[model samples]
Target: MTFLPPDPPNQSPAQRKRKKKKRKFPSQSGFWTMMKRKKAVEEPARVCGPSNKVELDPDLRFGLEKAKRQLESLRQDLTQFRDRLISARGSLDRITTEESETLEGVEVVIMRKEQDILGLEFDIHWATDYAAGSRAN
Candidate 1:
């Protein structure tokens, strides 16, 4: 059994005739595609102004002042950023130092060092110079 549908009873005589193949028109987008590709390969020409000295008007002076203020603001922002970075680095250093020197062990080491320094006999030459200086006073 065929799966094709039956033709409509109201079909026109024009519908019976075979339709001619359409002549495909080239796309407008594709026509400029090569030119668009060449644009990517080519370097854009740089525009240069005349080298003659131009007098600065009030408007130009205002623009220059505005630009200077913006530059100063940016410099301040960079300085603040650097200050924050330095502070962050310092905190990180402190954290690492604190981690390395645990409370119980580090305190014991510090105490031992203090005791050794305190128990040391003063150098004879240095002590004599100090005593002689005190007498001169």
Candidate 2:
């Protein structure tokens, strides 16, 4: 089974075939839009100049100046921190290098002491054998 809605008997075939009226959006046609366009045309062209000064609200200007000062202070602090870090790193490297060189010198001294002890032991052993042979004779 199929369901179908009956069309209106009063509406003619020509009326049904007629195109829908186009909608008028806010920008397309309006009293305010016309007035705004007219005002824009009447207004003088602003001079294009390279100006550093900006017209900001008093509160905004104060906040901007404060922010700039804070930024500069932060930059100075960052520079100091960087310098200190570099100095510390350099000191640490120098200390490490000095310690390694001192350790190397100590190792050389220890090796020389071991050699001297070995030479002394050899001389003592030779003297003991000489005394024993002389006593046996």
Candidate 3:
């Protein structure tokens, strides 16, 4: 069991009751009091951003919003243009590859045709010489 100290004999019943009713944590009471005083003295808070709505003029606010929208539109346009450019470049590369392959095939065919023409010319020259030799004999 806990031992209790005897109340001072000099103190009246009312004083003892008042002392008992005092805050149990005097330090905590001081902190709360300071917080209350600080809040009372402070002004209403405002946003610390680039634009404060309360201070901005109506015309200026409209202009700023319009500029933001324009910037967004331009950004989207740029993205679309860039995508189109990429697609065009891919199409060009594909077309170039196809043309190069077609060119190679055409060159092979031309070379074979040229060889056949040369062979026909050689045969014609040999036949003419043989006919001339036979007529002379």
Candidate 4:
């Protein structure tokens, strides 16, 4: 092949060489920008998340109310049980005799009350969720 000069008198040798070696691939930034624009346009319209508002059936509403009341009662019972446990602990510390050994039964009672409170709390949460109608109807 023979080398060719620029057509215009003012055109430089580099310009002539560049014209011969025209780019086949777009620049990195331009390619990324185009892809981003295409992605934005081609994407589905913004998706809406789950709606929290739900209608509660009458039975479920009653159950939820019952659960709420039960939960409150359990919480109060828990506070009383905790206070008793604290007092028992203090009494045990003061009297390290066989009296402390007898207090073991009181510890068991405190633990059972705690378990009951936890169970009630769980029930309340479940009842509230059920009442909220989480399932598709």
List lDDT for all candidates, in order.
0.46, 0.51, 0.53, 0.57
Per-residue lDDT tens digits for candidate 3, residues 4-31, read 6786899877798887796668699789
On lDDT, the candidate that comes out on top is: 4
What TM-score, to 2 decimals, does candidate 1 have? Answer: 0.27
lDDT of 4 by residue, 27-71 (tens): 978989987965543232222246544443455457656756665
Better candidate number, 1 or 4, judged by TM-score? 4
Number of clashes recorded per candidate: 0, 0, 0, 0
Model 2 residue 99 CA deviation (Å) reads 24
**Ranking 2 against 3 by TM-score, winner:** 2
Q: Estimated TM-score per prediction?
A: 0.27, 0.33, 0.30, 0.31
Q: Which stretches of candidate 1 lie over 4 Å from their true place?
A: 1-55, 91-137
Q: In model 2, which runs have C-alpha deviations exceeding 4 angstroms?
A: 1-19, 26-55, 91-137
Give the distance in Å from residue 1's predicted Cα in candidate 3 to where it truly belongs: 99
Query: Whole-model lDDT, candidate 2?
Result: 0.51
* lDDT against true structure, model 4: 0.57
Model 3 is weakest, by summed lDDT over 10 consecutive residues, at: 40-49
